[model samples]
Each structure stands twice: as C-alpha cells, then as structure tokens.
Target: MAEGGEDPQRLKKIAAAAYDYDNDSRWTDYWSNILIPPHMASHAEVVEHYKRKFYQRYMDPDLVVEPMSSTSSSQSARPSASTTNANEQQARSRSSGSVPRTAGPSATTGAANPSSVRWDQQTIQFSVNAWVFVIAVLAVLPLVPKNLSNRAYRLSFMGTACSSLYSLYALYGRPRAWNMQGMQVYFQSIVGAKDFIYFIYCLTFVTSNLCLKFALIPILCRALEQVAKFLRRNFTRSTIYRKYLEDPCVWVESNTTTLNILSSQAEIAIGFLLIISLLSWQRNFIQTFMYWQLLKLMYQAPVTAGYHQSNWSKIGRTVNPMIQRYAPFLNTPVTAVQRWWFR
Candidate 1:
C-alpha cells in the first residue's frame, strides 16, 4: 500500500463496501448498530470533521485537515485559502459526477448538478411523516374548528399511508418476476412486511363512512416517532429547537417503548370499539371485519407480536372470569371469537 498517495486496491475495497447500498453486509449492520447522538451528529462542524478525514484518507492524501473546537465558529470570518481550494475541488468533482454526494452543503448550492441535489428515500419519508404528525395533532385538538379538524384528520391518514407505501417500496422493491409463483411470493412477502401492514391499516379508514378517531392513535405514535428522529438529526442547532423542542424530542426518543405500548393498547381497544359500533347506527360491517383482520396481522407479525400479544393476554384474563360469572350465556360466543383469533 502507498503511504502518501491513493492506493487503488484499498480504495476499490472501500468503495465496494460503501457503494453496496442495496445489500446489507456484516460491515454495514455493525456500523448501523453503533449510533451517534443526534444532537452532536446534527452539527455542521462535526459532519465536516469526518468528511475532512475521509477526504484526507482516500480522496486526497495531501488534504490538510483542520481541527475545529466548539468555539471555532467565533474565531473565523472567512475560510482559509486551502479550505477554499478544497471546496472548489469538491464542487468540481461533484459536477463531474466523480464523487459521492450527501444531503449537505452541495445539495443546497446553486451550482450543484441534479444528482448532487437528489434526496434519499429516508429524507422523503421523514418529510412526509413530519407533516403527518403535525396534521394528526391538529385533527385531535378540540379548539380547532370542526371543518378544519375534519380536513386535517383526513389529510393525516392520507399522508401516513403514502409515506408507509413509499417506505415499503424502498425497503423491498417490486416483484422481480411476473409468473404465478413469483407473484404469490411477492404478495406473501408484502403481507408479512411490517410497513405494508401499516399502509393497509391507514388505508382501511381513509374512505370509511365511520369517523373512528381512535384509529388515529397508531398513526399518531408512528408519525411522532419518525418525525422526532428526523428533527433530532437535522434541527439540533436551531435556536427554536434548542429552546422549545429539545427536551420533548429527547423524551420521545428515549420512551419509544412507551409509545409503542400505548399504541398497542389503543389498537386493541379499537377492536372492541368496532364490535360496539356494529350495534350502532354508525356501523360499517366491512370496516369492522377489515380492522379485525389487520389486528390479527399485528398480533402475528414478529415485529409487533410481543406488544399485541401481551395486551391480548391481559384482556383475556380480565374478561374471561367476567363472562364466566356474570354472563355465562356469552361464554360460547367469546370462545368462538377466541378460536378465530388464534386461528
């Protein structure tokens, strides 16, 4: 290996691993688990520090790296000549499509080419989920006028369904082959995927005649979780974020399990609500049947099975004895539902 110049062999290996974006190898999985704190990771200097090191190591061996302190911003009014030259070189490389670009300075620069400014699917998902969370909150607030609240509620689910579908496609592409076996496998994979389930769950109520506000609980929690992640990763440096949003974001990030549990509880309760709704004038038999099937998927899916199963077990313990003592005649029907649930 060369000590003072780019080594093609080493560069080739690194580029292969880095650019193998579609497949997750052990190397990728290992780095994915080692997370940086969002507050620190969001800073421009921190990102530049790593970028400078990467360039020095592989892109330009002679690149002079600057050591920036927390107070470095106050000490400089203009970049040094070396830094200016490096930025120009980077811009040229980007324009020539010779370098990989991220969603950073180059993405916003006026001279950046189309490829340099293209946003990744995760960024698109984040943007969509952020709006979903905002609109979901507005939909629930009583102070909002009824017409506005209705519009907000409808829009929130639409946004959530769109984001969920896009995420599903990003994670797993369309069926590669179109034969009967290939189509069966593709549809099975989609059914078992967590994101697809979410898509279906949100879409179920999108055009329904019944306005079941409880259905919003899962969408609200899921949107809040994703939006909090994006905000923490992108907005830690903003004055408004530091003053008003930091603590809440921190809390949401830390209490993800709590949020998931709350969502699961709301979802289980919603099944009972649907059953009760069947007796009311607002009944939609198709919606009730569809939601229960979705619930069954939530119970069976590996990602959500634990939360939903725990809630289901607790409900059984509470309700079984009540049926035995107070309403033994209802015992047969409850047993029938239990059989269907397990099947």
Candidate 2:
C-alpha cells in the first residue's frame, strides 16, 4: 500500500522457489526486485541470516553491488527458522559471525558451489574411486609372478607404480592452492602417538617394492617425518573461517570436501598393518566387500537428496549394460583356475 513496501504474498513468491546453487538469485538483485520483507523476519539477525544465504549462494565476493534505490523497508526478506534452537543460534551467528562479503555484478564467472552437500558428496565419491582403484591395482600386482619376459608383468608393474605415486599425492590433498602457513597450522594440530602411528602406517605400503629385514624401520621413521611435515600445513583445518562462512561458493569443511579423507588415511593404515595377496582367503573376502561397496556407492549417486539433483535412470541405463557385459570377463579367470586345479 505504501510507496515501497511490497505485498507479503509477492515477497513470499520470490522466496518460495528453491535456490539452485549453480544458477542462484543475486544479493543486489534481491535488493532491487523484492521490496517486501517476509513477515517471519522477526529481527536484525534474521535479516542478516537471509543476507548471508543470498550473498553466499549467488553473488561473488569481488563483484560489488551497485547501489539500489532505497525503499520504505531496506532489509531483505527472511525465512522462518524451523525451530527455537536454530533461531537462538542464528542470533549468536549474527552477533559474533562476520557475514560473507557481497558483490554486485562483475565477480569472476560464478565459481563452483563449494558448500553444496551434493557437490561435496560427489567429489568425495570420485576421489574414493580413484585412490581405491589405485590401491586395488597395487595390491593385485604383487600377486603375479615377477617375470621380466612376461609383458603383462612389466606393464602392470609400471602402471601400479605410477598409480601408487598418484595415491600419495591424493593423500597429500590440495597441495597447489594450500600454502606453507596452512601446512604449518595443520602440523601444529597433530596430537599424540596415534597420529605418529597413522603417519607410519602410510609409509610402510608406500615403499612396498623394498623387501629388506630392517626396511620398515627407515620407512616408519620417514613416514613419521613426512606426516610431521604434513601436519604443519593449514590446508587440513576443519572449520569454515567465520569471515568466509557466508560464501556458499567456498568450502566449509577442509577434510570433508573430497574423499572420506580420514578413511583414505585409515586405508593406508590397514595396508601397512597387513600384507595383501591375491591368493590369500583375505583377498577374496576383501574383493567381495569392495565390489559391494562400489556398487552401493555407485547406485547412491543417482538417489536425489532434498535439494540435490541427479539423473538415476540415465545413469543406470548406461552403466547396467556395461556391468552385464563385463561380468563374465571378470568371472572367467576364477572359473578356469578352479576347474584346472581340481581336475
């Protein structure tokens, strides 16, 4: 009814549509277009929370917002908090938290949505598959006879070695963008003999090519040294810095982004604790477990979460046929070996 205050229903309409992390509503765009604040925005904190959601979800930090023509109510609309605790905590975040920076239009081509649960989960899955494949290859290589004349032997060796190196880098995590200061911060966070043990565990399998009586001593010491160095790096810090928390395009959890980083670390630990051989009963067991896990994880990718999108039908149509075709190829070797040995 007034000069600038818009109808509550109009404000509700603008806010009701789900925000897509990839194609989002802009911070200033909201300021310009949606003049009516939602009735549920009870206080300044609620308004601040809404501001955080918009700026982080849509706008880039460097792109400054052009000044909007002021209206009767300047604050943006806010959604109702789902519960009392969230509302109270939000108040705290408003008071203590440094809200994410807002930019208007010329920020970098909108960066990747770093905090989207779906995005992070997908990335984690990819990283897991990558390193797991490498680990499997490395585990299987030791089983085959070491005959230089056998072309398969040489190819598998070289391939396994290269994959091993890449796995080390994957364990190292994001090295290029992470700096020395961050590394140092991470190092400082390491506490106790368990951390030292975990680091040593990583070293044992890394140097599996060596088969000396005391080889483990040097490897253990070196593992400790490298992990000590790794601890110093800040790239592993867990919490989203308060100032940067508002930016939806930025990562919230340092470790959770790609792969079950802790599990990957633990995988190296298990590799060190026991020697893996394809002939052993353990191999069959573990292989069976891995296959099930891979299939389960693969299927999960297509399951849409609340705000996440996926094309499960399309994915299944493509992968299902490939699985059926390859199933016999994988089983043929075991079947042949069984018949030959028994007969």
Candidate 3:
C-alpha cells in the first residue's frame, strides 16, 4: 500500500498487463503451448482438490472426480484437427456463393455506416390512402343492403372489386428482391386489421343472406297467397267459381289447406334461419368472453375449466329435453288451420 492506503499505479499496470496477455494469447498459441499443455494431465487432480475443499467448507459429502486417460486425449486431437480443416473448406465453399453480407452492430460503427433516406411525403400519403381504402371496404361490406335503395350498393361492390384488384397488382408488380419480413411489415401496416374485421363482416353477410332467403322470402310468399285468395274470390263470378269447383283437383290445389301448408313450410324455414342466427350470436359472445379470459389468464395465472363446463352442461341439459320433446313435432303434419276450418 502507498499513500492513503492505495497502490493506484501498480493496480493499473497489473490490469493493463493482464488485458494485453489475454488478447495476445487469444490470437496466438502462447498460453496453450507454454502453460495449459503442461497442466492438462493434472487437470483432474486440481479439480478434485477444489471440489473437496468446497465440500469440507459446506460440511457436505465429497464429490467423485474421474480423470481422462492420456490415450483418449491424444486420440481426440486427431478428430478435432480433421473437423477444423473440414469447417474451413465448408466456409470457403459458402463464400463462393452470391449471398449478401450483413453488417453487425460493431461493423456499422464510424465510417462503415451507410446513410438512410426518408420516404417522400407523396409516398407516405399514398400508403395512408391505400390503407384507408382497405379498411373502409372491409368495414362496409356487411352493412350494404340486399335490396338496393340507390347506386350506393353497386358503388360499394365496385370499390371492393377495385381494392382486390389493387392488392393483386401490388403483390405481383412489387420488386422481387423485397424480403419476406419487409413484405409482412408492409401488409401489417396496410391491411392487417382487415383480417379480424373481415371475419365479422362475413358473419354478418351470411346472416343477412339467410334473412333475405328464409325470412323475407317466406313472408313474401304468404303475402302473395293472401293476394291470390282475395283476387280469386272477388274478381271471379259464380259461374266461373262453379266451373272451377267442378274440377276437384283444381279446388284442392287452390284451397286454404294448400296455402296453409305452404305458409307452414315458410314458417319452418324462417324458424331454422332464426335458430342459426341465434347460435351465431351466442358463439360470438362466448368467443369474445373467452378471448378476454385468455388475456387475463396470460397476465395472471390459469383459470379452471370447471366454470365453463358447468355452465355448458346446464345449457345442454335444458336444451336437450326441449329438443327431444319437439322431435315429434318436426315430422308431424301441420293440421291446425285445416282442422279448425273443417270444424
């Protein structure tokens, strides 16, 4: 120790010498040839001594040490040398290819760094416009009317067509050198939200189609039947009615019973459509809740499946009985209106 209980200069010299020796030996065979090789044979003995000392200090059982045989060590060097040569040859072969060199953090420092150019305002604006168009199309598709009120529905469909065309153009016309990561980032920036939005849109679209086909069509059919009945009773005279009544097949075909059967079938179709829509709504609600539950579980810990299973079991028991009771009605002839009229 020097003045103030410090040996500053001495410590600095020792550190510098150690650092220099490490760097030199790492690049050369200095330590391996002069120091390590001589002590390599006694490595197990040194390790055993340290292990025994550690165990004694801790009052633990002594660790067993197994020494490597000299013959094994000598034989290992031959394979190691052969592997090194093979690796060097492989490296040379790889270097002959046209793969681009990547700059690491250290390589990018100082004069090795390259300049980056920012995108122009026009390019940024175009990208923003493209993304806006994609989002608008996906969001509006489900809301478009089946019964066209104006030119808006047609316009919306055209917009979707145009956007799809643009997407195809962008996919095929882009530069081939663009890497997958860059393309993915580009797509995420532009229309990644559409993936989720489109799912909802498709559900709504299918539901709307079903409403048009089943509910609206059935109601329209019922209205047409009523109109036909009114026109037949009012416009036709007694003579025409008597002539039609003489043909029993014609009377049976146009009778109230036949109309009631048609209406009943229509009602069934509507019922089926409503049931499907109800199931879809329920699934959406359950999935939304499940997704939130999953997020909570991720942040905290796992939740038990018992609650979900119990609720579903209760629902199944309730629905199953109703379904079984109604199973007979599904095939039973709808005769209420006929029986009432006949009575």
Q: Which has the greatest TM-score?
A: 1
Off by over 4 Å in 1: 1-119
Q: Rank the candidates by lDDT, best first.
A: 1, 3, 2
| Best prediction by lDDT | 1
TM-scores, all models, native as reference:
0.65, 0.23, 0.20
Model 2 regions more than 4 Å off: 1-128, 134-138, 141-143, 147-184, 190-200, 208-343
lDDT digits (tens) for residues 204-230 of candidate 1: 888886777778899999998887877
lDDT of 3: 0.36
List the candidate 3 regions with Cα displacement exceeding 4 Å: 1-145, 149-210, 237-253, 281-343
Candidate 2, residues 1-343: lDDT per residue as tens digits?
1126666444433443333433432334333332333553454544554554444323222122222223323344222222322343333233223342333243241122222533454344344333433433433455545442233323333333343344332322222225898556433322122223323333433434332222233222222232322332322363642244323212212322122332333333333333344455434444334433332333233211111113334444765577568775655665564455234
For model 3, the run of ten residues with the poorest summed lDDT: 56-65
Report backbone clashes per prediction. 0, 16, 0
Error of 3 at 79 (Å): 99
Candidate scoring better on TM-score of 1 and 2: 1
Candidate 1 TM-score, true structure as reference: 0.65
Across 1-343, the per-residue lDDT of candidate 3 in tens digits comes to: 1246556455533433343332332223212222223333365543333333223212211123232334544554544533332343333223222232343445244214222211232233234333433443433355656444223323333333343334333322232236888567444433322222222322332333232233222223333333344334344666765576434423433464444445334433433344455566444443333333332222222122333334435655875577568765732343452243234
Q: Give candidate 1's root-mean-square deviation (CA, Å).
A: 13.6
